[model samples]
Target chain A: MNHLTLALDTMGGDHGPHVTVPAALQALSVYANLHLILVGDRPTILTIMRQHRASESERLRILHAEQVVQMGDKPLHALRRLKHSSMRLALDLVANGQAHACVSAGNTGALMTMAKVVLKTLPGVDRPALVTALPTMTGDPVYLMDLGANASCDSQALFQFAVMGSVLAEQVAGKSNPRVALLNIGTEEIKGNDQVQQAARLLQSTPHINYTGYVEGDRIFSGEADVIVCDGFVGNVTLKTTEGIARLLMHQIAQSVKRNPLARCLSWLLKGRLKKLFLQMNPDHYNGASLLGLRHIVVKSHGNADELAFLRAVEEAMTEVQRQVPGKIEARLQSVLLEKSC
Target chain B: MNHLTLALDTMGGDHGPHVTVPAALQALSVYANLHLILVGDRPTILTIMRQHRASESERLRILHAEQVVQMGDKPLHALRRLKHSSMRLALDLVANGQAHACVSAGNTGALMTMAKVVLKTLPGVDRPALVTALPTMTGDPVYLMDLGANASCDSQALFQFAVMGSVLAEQVAGKSNPRVALLNIGTEEIKGNDQVQQAARLLQSTPHINYTGYVEGDRIFSGEADVIVCDGFVGNVTLKTTEGIARLLMHQIAQSVKRNPLARCLSWLLKGRLKKLFLQMNPDHYNGASLLGLRHIVVKSHGNADELAFLRAVEEAMTEVQRQVPGKIEARLQSVLLEKSC
Candidate 1:
């Protein structure tokens, strides 16, 4: 790849072009061989570029997107009506091969829907699952899929998710045949609802994948598994709960340290370690949500993403393009789904 | 409350009486109107009791329970076969009214099973739900009901759970007209599965609860509502996810902060706040899982609980007893169920 170009949705996220533009510039500086196709309001993009003292504004081309997708708008309505929305135009770039990959921090539903409609799922790919990487206790990040894409699921979809998630883990984490576990109420085969039970049966019999049986929500943090798979509903709930609890703890710690003189002394003792830990667990550190199993690479940034977070999403896109993740997923999924039909 | 005699299932947790004994003695000093009925292997309890020079030991009585419930043993098997288990005998005390409530950090299923068979559900209460209090962002604890008692729930059971949970919130959190929300995939009335949608419709039209419509799992910590009602399966998954995420973040924080000197310095500055936050978030501080809709109070302590956690369970029991929580729940439920019939 001489100079791979990624279409960055600059008008996306809570901070829009102000954050996305700077993050894109940072990525461009870090990777000299990378190019960016910035999609947003022309004036805002130019203003942000000027503020960054970016001379290579020519290298980062701005594509005017007259409309923007608001986070609160109905996903289907926004996708259907706002054809010129920054997120839609960015995704269209990938669909039409104008860019190597697409990254967006806009309305998640709209982005996913547009990507699915424009880029379409790989043949035999049942659902384009959203995968979020979370930092584990062992300092390695684990790939957790179906964070909020599909609320309801079937056995086949979950099995496919396992395959896609496993491939991503292997490529991203460099763990060959990473231990993949089906998130369930218990580790027993008999545990969980019909969807999980069916998925377990399919996963156990499926070859070419290392199935680690069921893993409870508690074990997700223990760094025991590399790839955790569950229905979208459970995955979404788990991810959000994790975020909420982290915030709650962080806030409480701040309150406690500021409360008393003795605590102040203790805080002084542990200051360096705590901030490092807090930063490590920061959501921005693992900001990208990969739209796995699609024909093209599409990473969803958090809706409220800042500059650093959007940059992380760009890095994710770069990594995916370098790894040819979509092609790998296509090959693995084809074999699995083809074998099932045979 | 004249010298309330309580049975501590000393051999119940992973660390057992080592933690439970010290915690109980500490609690004895704190709660002057408390007595002990230490139930476990006589020699072990005696050894631990001898270490603590607490004068309350004179009032301490040991009941030999040779068989203990293994954490991994099946719920019903432990309940039926382990007739001589300390956990069982502890429940026996409650069944016979010798003790007001029983606290154990043993197999949760066995505790629930034993409680149901022993104490029975309150009148008009079809099922006994498990309720756990999670720290909310609003600086108040939110009561999430049916955390895992029943895996599957119908519309009626969920509604009843809302009633029971709301009453507990009002009685416990002191929130009058405690806002009740049905946990769903989305906040919209039309956003969830058939079960959740039906529950939302019932909650919306129903007059008893201060229903706030549907709430996604993310909103649980947002503190937008006081009581969140969901089927046992969803609630259990959400609760475990919250726990798993908290543990994940804490482990990450500890590992990162301890790695370097500057990070350690930052950790020192944040240690007081961190400890306070972590301790507050510790399941131990809010260790009790109340058996709701039951005629009597039954709190499920963490199976791996230490002494401080068990002592907190005792305090929780005292709070319930002093507040007459069961009676209030019973009265509220009776009135609501009666209204439903009409």
Candidate 2:
């Protein structure tokens, strides 16, 4: 395999270098051909690296950044004032061809805005989308897109999301012809608003895409479709609601186990199985979401991700880098648009 | 307390009389002041009633209807052609003052359309929203509204939903001053579409509602706010996503426990505690959703609800009827509208 270099936004997440440095080292141990350019304040990165006894080898280097983008800062504010922030510097490395991809556990809005401005959008794409892979019952991951990049979308935008999402699944998920469906309240053609209905018509008539009909939210994890498309508002809310419910249920289980003496005693025996189950369902395991439709691979890690979660994000970026996801998306989108115009 | 009579559409859900009949009987046993009028095909309902050894009393009666609304039937089709259908007849009973409330586990769009046409909207209300109570970590349920009543809502529509939802929380949930917030991708005021921002501004300025700025989807179960408001599209997707994730997690736990011998043994010992926890988080416990802003109370049950789930819906409707939710909403909305106009 060829060498893959990823620009690390070392001062991005809540704990910054403390989390990113350990995660980067762990990822390096897994991928022998991996290279990293850590972007952050130089002294902090160096100190953490020394603590881990990781040296600047041929595959790893540190790039100094002067400022940081606070999680609370607005996207526009970060763009204007924090031009030299770790997040922006890392994105610049990818745009300048110095890194194969970039990974950041930072403010989502800021990362999206800066990445779009720096890397630019792919050909025939107006706005980029946040796409993530979720575990499903069939053991195949489903790719869900437009996870909050654009708040409100029209029929045309939704159509674009479908195209982008299908390309991602085909190239990255290794699905030959990924079935794509619109997310709606009901499965009927006349169920949702005019925008969704119009998008559905377009998808149905398109020959280049395997466009399935509507899929309701309750069936999202059933693995019935490879790609599920929706407007950003709906997608974001659906994603977060799923996370919230998972957390709530786990909490309930723990509380119940503690209250009963028999359950508490039994919990000790079931600890290993319970741990494995919780690990599979943990949101941390699914940390990184690809910023699709951009000119380069940009993976956004969850802001609160710890070392293991952040390592998963680095692995996600590495996979995208090896697959050349953006190039595939651009080529597919151009052909689809040309066919539509004809 | 005055006797609360409920008109139940026995031919509504997937199993029709099988689920609704037993659920109604169970509900009658729970509430002494409860009365039910079962409307469906006479022979089928009678057969089920006799099998359950339930005979008509002063509080429980049978209202036969010649036709039934198929679960897949369109709302407009049901309204135009199936005037005497069981679902339509139940709404009519509420409209004609024979029943204080109506409960149906039927097609949602059809039920909403028929309810609005028969009962009409309350004064100054343009659309009725679907509002349901969700269990929260704080042990108090948070009321979420517009869970698929109107798919695409404007700023004014969202404002109306907030008003109606607040009234429901206060009257039925028994909160004196409900803290209501708009559901958005982010908690920032500028995070969502223009309609949401405008609605937030209106909510903040309104005197009656305790309008908190914004609530993100993940924090919805945190119990930070008493009421969460959004368009039907977002609300529906969020609610369904929560259900899906809960189902997925439970399935994971069951599978993992079965795979390990120790875990399987522990699961048997922990069965009682696990059962209680599952019961509390069960979607069936939160089945009924009220159609707020309607002139009379109309509760919608899950189409797939079993006997216990349907019983919970009946209990929910009884709670609303005893609380006089619609009457309270009418009075509060009139004053709020008057205040807004001035």
Candidate 3:
């Protein structure tokens, strides 16, 4: 396997370097051909690295960033003021070809805005979509797109999202001729608003794309479709709702087990199997969300992700790097656009 | 409490008289003051009633309706051709003041259309919103609205939904001042589309409705807000996604328990508690979805709901009828509209 280099935004996310440095070291241990450039405050990064005995590793390096982008900072404000922040510097490494990809557990808006400005979008792509894999009953993950990147999208933008999402699933997930479906309230043709309806019409006409008409939210986990496309508003709400429900159910189960004596004993006996099952469905297991349609790869980890979760994001970025996802998307999109113009 | 008579469409839902008849009979047994008018084919209803030993009950009565509305029938078609259908007859009982409310597990579109045409909207309501209670961490259910009655809505329609939902929560759920929040992609003021943003502004200034800003989809289960309002498309997708996640998690847990010997043994020991927890989170436990803003109450059960689920719908309708929900909403909406006009 070829070497994959990732730029780590150490000063990002809730715990910053406390989580990122350990995650970076763990990723290095997992993949022998991996290298990481840690971007953050010099003293903080060095201290954490020394504590972890990580300085002796040849694959690890550090780049000091002058400023940090606070989680509460707006995208535009971060873009204008925090030019040398860790998040911006990490993406700069990807744009400047110093790394194969950039991974950040930072403010989603700031990371997206900075990556767009630094890496630019692929040709024939108007906007980048935040794409993430969600676990399905079939055991194969479904790639869901526009997970809060654009609050509102037009028909044309939704069309682009479908294109970008399909390409990502096909190229990265290695699903040939992936089935793509537009997310709607109902499966009927007359169900959604004009934007989704129009996008469906466009997808149906587009050649070389397996555009399944529409899939309702209830069918998302059924694994009937490989890629589910929607505007960011609907997509974000759907993803968050799924996460919230999972947490609520687990909490309820815990409470039930505690209240019953037999349940408590049974819980202890079934702890291993139950823990494995919980981990399989845990959101942290699928923490990385790729910023698709950018000229280079940039993966966004959850803001509150711990070391293990952040490492999963790094692995996600490495997979996209190996697959050459950005180039594949550009080629596919260009061909589709050419077909349309003709 | 005064006697509350409910008109149930015995021919509606997947199992028709099989489920609805049993459900109605079960409800009568639970509530002594409750009375039911079962409308469907007379012979089918009579057979089921006799089989259940329900014919001896004085509270149960049969209303003959020669025609039946198929689940696939469109609302307009059902209105035009199936005037005397069981579903239509049930709503008619409510419209003619013979019953306090109507309950059906029929086609949602047809039910909404027929009810709107027969009962009409309240003085100020422009459209009827679909409202249903969702289980929350606090054990108090949150009333979520516009589950799929209207595909699209303007700012004013959303405002009306908020007003209607707030009143329902206050009157039926007995919350003095329900904290109402607009469902959005983000909690920030500038997060959603123009319609939602506009609705938020309107709700913030509206008097008497405890307008807590925006709540994200993930926070809906957190039980922070009593009423969460959104357009039909978003609401429908959110509700379905939640149900899908719940089913997926439960399935996975069952699989995990089955796969391991110790886990299987433990599952049996904990079966009682686990069963109770699952039952609490089960969608069927909260089956009824009330069609608010109509002059009279109409509760829509899930089309595939079983006997127990259908009985829950009847219980939901009774709660609203006892609370005089429609009358309370009309009074509240009239006052809110009056305040707006002044």
Candidate 4:
């Protein structure tokens, strides 16, 4: 049937099997030929599988992974000690080519560490970055890279992230030479810290890139640029703050609407629209952040991600596989690495 | 009536006299003894003032200045050359005690430099920091420091920012022993870069402040902490990103509501509450980020701020005057500085 199978860490995430199981079933239903290596506490997956009457259990193979990484545990500690952990086992499946990719809604750091140790960096990648797509005001997605992958980075790393982010956007989003920007305080050439300024210089002179110069934080969601690049430290903070602020705003709107009966009636009328908006802002919709430059695909879903988010993450991996994005990124990055050596 | 006059820079912001003049008049309406020194192009301010039929023209002293600081000009270059600029003149009034504080929706960097050079830093204060209050999910505002004042900072600088942020929160928000937190990638003490880790060590052991330990960016708007401290670089990015994401989400909500007649009707009903929520997200409501550590009070309004924002900034200055927050912050910081030198 020319379909692909993915290994999912169903025991991961806050909702665990409740959400993961349903999402797995949903994904399987969408692609009749899709098989899932359900890695988790086997009993839990079977119990969840039974609820869905997933006759496709024949396609869904359950692997007994006795442990799941807690969100708070150190990544190194979790990976080094928990060899049979669900996330680790999932990565092994992908590494050994038992599955095309590994997806987890667990500890992000632990996922990165396991993937790195198991699969290793693609030929010439020095560091792998986590890249996620954010919806812009123009209704198009903007890919932001190094979103908490490496908290401290130099100019060369940022430039590489831009290259990787751009390649992914082109391959996955199907954009041709997406307009790229380095996130900064001001749009001026002279604005931002040393790393951002240095990256800007490289991007400006780089021949193959569609460099758009510096973009202020305010313009990030405006669709002013297609690819936003920054050090993992800033990108991580920016992404988290954006989510927090959205949640805070949504909560505030709910409280204000409930304060009066007239407003309450209006909220009911607008409930569907508001839900859609919330869904659009949902961390799940953009849940899967890919670890770019890895030899094999590894997508880290949010720890508290729901079924919908996990489903999207699995879909993201499938898309990556279909487009051969990882291979293309590796080739482009390898050339840069070669040039640097010369 | 211990209230004092404030010098308002009218020829500032993307939408200048149109918004600034009305906002100044609005501020004067709230405070009975309020006097405004409208520093800008005389003809423009007069025309707007006349249109508003502002009865307090006598109280509204227009100090005509011929020069203006364009947003693109370098901060140091503008501050040095544009000596008679409206923004510079406004700060001069405050520095000379002709006004208790200066307010400007002008070139932020220029205002900061001019204020620092003119007002000088409080003894034992290394640099002045810009502080703003962000609305949190708990319905109370969390005070965040160094919202783009100093780009690069040391451990001591961050520690001092925490102390200053704590004092301002307590004095202004009536928060007793405000919980202070350093923004980091992770909650662990050893998780962040060297500066963040070192800052954590000192903040955790500080006696004058109620240190709550490190908080991730997601918790900033959750109201889990009272005072959030970070370097100017991180703070600026966080603040702007919050605004950008909120705008994106709200716009998405509006678009979704218009997709169908039923949803559109409901949107209209809940429009007031939604608008109120949006207003709370307004950057201007949180305008007048104070330059703490300055010997004299210095408040910076957003360069693209409107009249409503300028009025809110005046209110912020008034709050500082009543709380005498700077004095308290200096006293605590001096003791810490003394200990360090010893």
Candidate 5:
């Protein structure tokens, strides 16, 4: 927290430099002890900065990255071919301690692959799970993990995700012994697939984790549990499904208001409150997903994130850096390991 | 259409006779050509019928089914032990040609299992997938299938779902050459698990299916495709998550309206529209899911459905019966099979 330097993948996502550069300036203004290294094409980054009436300083450095990872590029291609890409360079900066964290509004698969290749995993971890914060009705944000990280994870991988998620909930969300539940179609013992049942067994045996049993999708926002863990495939689909409903409802309100005179009159007066509700309900666009169990912090923003969203992603990275998320997860794992050995 | 009869599992849902009896009266009034067999405790059904100022007649028969499949009953237990249960009896009526279709709001697992055991699957069908109609932006409801039927499905099962879904969309939703999409994390060739990728290959090779490639969860309500197919696990979670969001948004609106005076005034004026929007947005509660690929029609209402929702389920069963959904699916499969042999 003394002085934080974070790298930005300015040549990623749909908007690229247009969003990242403005977000970088905003982050610099918010965090007095913050430094941002913009990694992208030199001319475009500089031009965007100039357009925003800003210039590079000690706290703001422009690091030229020649290649840009396209949205359609496969993970393997991004890993093997685009070595000097902005996404890769930003992750490289984090790996070598040039920055405390890295933020990207890039293709998720590419970033996941590159971050794993560059920073490697924390010791005793096989895979890094993608964890995102979701708002609950109880005024606490529940952390859901493995959001399209490992499509078909083994029981061991799910157990590890539970540990990492617990660490996140405690360190970042500031919850004590956060209750963790496995996301399943049903809550009964007879429910879920083999891997989930096996993971439930593993979680039950672990002393440090406050393992609540399985939770169905309908209970996700009920605040019955602080953290929900599942294989990446299910998690990703569930997260996006939530986002889809948010979009659907927003669209429905708009269309309905247009047709209904009474609703239209009310909509004009409650515009601000309604906009905030829509924004607050949509977590993927407003917040970022952290790749937990990595050696360094990396937050993945939505691909089509606007300036405000990308800035929120940078803030997410800064918060993870301040909380030392990876360090705490490592420590928690060691203690769990010790308990098992005893 | 000829006279249609639907066997209702009067004691299956949480509300038992309270919801089903009132709903039966409504269905009888709506469809003059319809006859209903209410299967439950005879005394209770008679009492509820009397409450509605209706008595047993040729159009409405009360079949005594003493055993009730509880909401928490296991599928195996219901299948083996609860043969006289109202859910099983209703299914039995359909099997013996006493009823054209059966409607239940019992435990989904029990209903699915008993449905297969009594009515059986279509000759070439591996499993009977759960299909539901979701309201879309195009005003025509899109069909989604395998909503917790087979938790982990092979490519073959997924392909079968696609064929059945196409038939439903064409016959029921009346969408010609209905576009079918597989639900996945990304739309790339390298994205998704082995099952989904393999399923995509199968769909691409099949001539009858208008496979539109992969679609993410966020594109579900966009009306980009007529049918979306997924394994039971992801499909079930996606659906319940949608329901969860609907609940959360409704709760938020109520809570927020209470806090803001401007919003409160708007909410008062927009009360009817808001209620309709919320009800329309929550499909699981508004509509029942049909067990596709079955020999007979079986519509599973939401467990906690009210009288209106139960009435909708009765209407859904009647629609399928009039459309001869099972027969149409049989013919479509026969044609596809003939094409394959060529």
Candidate 6:
């Protein structure tokens, strides 16, 4: 906890170094114990820092990355051809013990692939799951995974996701004995598919998990469970769908107010309150999603994250490093898997 | 087109006759040529009608049902024991020639099971998909399915959904050459699973469908594609997640406003506008989801729908009845299947 180092994929995402450079400086200023290694085109990073009237100190360093990963780069293509890309170098820094964590707002597919290839999966983890905290109505945010990290997960993989998700909820979110639930369909009707049903069976027989029975999707935001588990495909769709609906309703509210003069005048008076509420629901506010089950920490920010949102990603990485998330997850998973065998 | 008759499961939903009876009368008042047969405990329906100083007239009639399907009833159990239930009786009316369609705000599992058994699937259709209209940002609502009708779907079944969804959009929504898209995960990165890829191939090859490749969950409300197809599990989770997120933000907004006195007072001034916006986003506004691919028309309303929401179900049933959606779907599916065979 005395010293923490994080590698920033400065050439990742839509804005690349322009956003990541300022965010890295902001994070360092806030966390005096933090050290940041900017991994991108060195010239671009230096120019951005200069524009902000900033220079490198003992807490900061620049590592040049020859290439940048585009937003649309395929994972395998980036792995094979763009090995020196900023996203890849950031993970490599963590892989080689040069940094405790890596944060990127870059191409998700490329980052997931390069992180897995470079850092490798934690022992006993088949594939890493993309995990993030979802805001609830009244209680603390619930952790959800595997947000498109693995498209096709079998029952065992799903069970592993439940384990990793629970660990993150406990260690990162500080929820004790966090109740975990499998995201399944059907309210009072037919249940989920074989993969989910099998996962439920595995979780039910395990003492390592505080497994509540299956939960419907409507219960996701109700805060009835601490960690919600699903395969990458379902989780990804659900997360994106939530984003889409939030934006839709917000747009509808704004457009409706624009049509009426009296309502518009009254709304302008309450604009400050409304703006605060909108920010709370905005997807950008919750930017960092950790790629769990990896050997080391790697936090993925949104592709279009702004300076503050990118800084949120850096802070998320800091928490994971401080909590030693990977080490705790590896220990917990090994015990759970061992107990399951018995 | 001149006369449309819809059977109502008056003993369905949480409020039973209290909600359905009033909604039936309202539907009758709206459409002069519409007739409704209320299936429930005859005395309860009569008492509610008497409370309104009304009697059964030529356009409205009451039929006795021995039982009512509870919200938690399992599909197979309800199918076997609840033969004379109000939900079943309503479908029976549509199955025979007593009514053109059936509207039920009852147990979804029971309604789907009984409707499928009594009405059977259309020719060339494997199973009926639960279809609903989703609100879009700048265009007419998009048709999404299957919203939990089938737990799993193969490539062929997904192809069938695309074909059927197109018909609903074209005939009921009055959209010509409606663009069809398969719901997939991974945005600018990895693609979907084998079934989805195979379905994409089928859609691309078929001239009958205006295939628009794969669309992610975030694009559901973007108004880009008119029809989005996915398996029941995925579609169900997406729909419910949308509902959950919408409610979460609404709750957050209401709670935030309550904490500020100035905001609350001014909000009360703009109450009419805010209330209108809330009403637009409320899940109850979209009550009915049609059981597509059935031989007879069936509109399944939410189990907790109030009087007005239940009336929306009746109106949806009327639209499907007027459009003769089942026949259009059947004819279109038959041709699509034949072409596939050739």
Which candidate number has the best lDDT? 5
Q: Model 6 over residues A1-342: C-alpha lDDT tens digits?
A: 679999999998888888889999998889989999999999889999999888988789999999988988788889999988888888888888999999999888888888888999999999999988888886588888889988889999999999999999999889899999999986332388989988888998999899997888888999999999998889989888877776776677678789888777877777776666555554434558999999999999988888999999898899898898999999999999788788
Residue-wise C-alpha lDDT for candidate 2, range B3-40, written one tens digit per residue: 88999999998888999999999889988888899999
Candidate 3 positional error at A12, Å? 0.8
Query: Candidate 6: where is the Cα deviation over 4 Å?
Result: A187-190, A282-287, B187-190, B282-287
How far out, in Å, is residue A272 in model 4? 3.2
DockQ of each: 0.45, 0.69, 0.69, 0.70, 0.74, 0.72
lDDT digits (tens) for residues A209-235 of candidate 4 = 788988877788899888999877788
> How would you encode candidate 5's per-residue C-alpha lDDT over A115-198 as one tens digit per residue?
998999998799999989888888799999889999889999999999999999998889999999999989999887899999
Model 3: per-residue lDDT, tens digit, B1-342?
678899999998888999999888889888999989999999999988889876845578889999998877877999999999999999999999899899999988899999999999998889999988888998888998889898788999999999999988888788889999999987777678899999998888888789999998779989999999998988888888876776676677787777778777777777766666655554634568999999998999888888889998998898888888888888888888888888
Q: Which portions of model 4 miss their true places by more than 4 Å?
A: A1-3, A51-58, A284-287, A337-342, B1-3, B47-60, B339-342
Interface RMSD of 2: 1.8
Q: Which one wins by DockQ: 1 or 3? A: 3
lDDT of 2 by residue, A1-342 (tens): 479899999998888999999999989888899999999999998999999999888788999999999999999999999989999999999988999899999999999999999999988888999988887878788888889999988898899899999988988889989999999999988899999999999998898899989998878988999999998988888878776665665677677678778777778777666656555553534558889989999998888888988998998888887888888888888888899999
- Which 10 consecutive positions of candidate 1 chain B have the poorest summed lDDT? B277-286
C-alpha positional error of residue B233 in candidate 6 after TM-score superposition, expressed in Å: 1.3
Query: Can you tell me the DockQ of model 1?
Result: 0.45
List model 4 lDDT by residue over B36-132, tens digit each.
8989999888888889886446567989999998777788898789999998898888888888777787778888888889888877678888888
Q: Write the per-residue lDDT of candidate 6 for residues B1-342, one digit (tens) a residue.
A: 678888999988889899889888888778899999999999999999998777888789898998988888888899999999988888889888999999888888778888889999998889889988887898588988999888889998999999999999998889999999999995331398888999998998899899998888878999999999999999888888876776676677678789888777877777666665555543434558889989999998887888899999888888888888899999998888889899
lDDT of each: 0.80, 0.86, 0.87, 0.82, 0.89, 0.86
B22 Cα displacement, candidate 2 (Å) = 2.6
- Measured by DockQ, the strongest candidate is 5
Docking class of 5: medium
